[model samples]
Target: MLRVAVDRDGGVTLDDVADATREIDRVLEESDVMGELPFTLEVTSRGVDRPLTLPRHWRRNEDRLVKITLVEGGEVTGRIVASTEESATLDVDGDTREVLYADVAKALVQIEFNRKKKQNDSEDA
Candidate 1:
């Protein structure tokens, strides 16, 4: 299945997914990119299980707890404090650690069902 994940400043709704699917279908029908291939599409919002790979991904996950695997084989578990294009600052056991994007091999948001929602920015799937 072709998965289309989308997010917004507030949140994504069912209608948003339906609208996005329709728009994608319309665009593909107007173009020859698929070359008569019949394909099924599944549109979804970003899931917490998805790894944090890009600067925007890191930015989107600010304040969430994460487990990061370093390129040098080090592992870090911390709550995201701040993030930029090049690095992320995490609060690791009361100590703040700064990690460069290049040093991160993989990063995934940790699940915390009892976690309090920060302002209006709660990470959603």
Candidate 2:
């Protein structure tokens, strides 16, 4: 089975996966990269469990909760308020903390099953 992990700034949608799969299938068929052997091609998004390593990854996860491990030795859990190429700003317990990418050993997005959605003005009325 061939598995392809797709990622985007905001997130990966079903349409994106479908488009990628079609393109990949076309390329493989044209190039005959897989020879005569039949195989399954599975395309999916980089799951929430995937570690945030790049600036883009951090940017993509903005507004999401994350658990970060510092290189110096410690952990922090907070919501990603903002991120730049060099660092990310997190809201931890109502306090904002800026953490440089160089200081981050690992970071993973946390899953919230019952997260409250931001209510729109129309919804408030």
Give the clashing residue pairs of candidate 2, or none.
none
Per-model TM-score on C-alpha atoms: 0.68, 0.85
Off by over 4 Å in 1: 8-40, 117-125
Q: Per-residue CA lDDT of candidate 1, range 46-125, in tens?
A: 87888988888888778789999999998999998898889999999999999998999999999998977667765774
Name the candidate that leads on TM-score: 2
Quote the positional error of residue 117 for candidate 2 in Å: 0.6
lDDT of 2 by residue, 3-117 (tens): 9999888887788999999999999889877889998999999889889999999988998999999999999999999999999999999999999999999999999987777
CA lDDT, every model vs. true structure? 0.86, 0.92
User: Model 2 RMSD to the real structure?
Assistant: 3.1
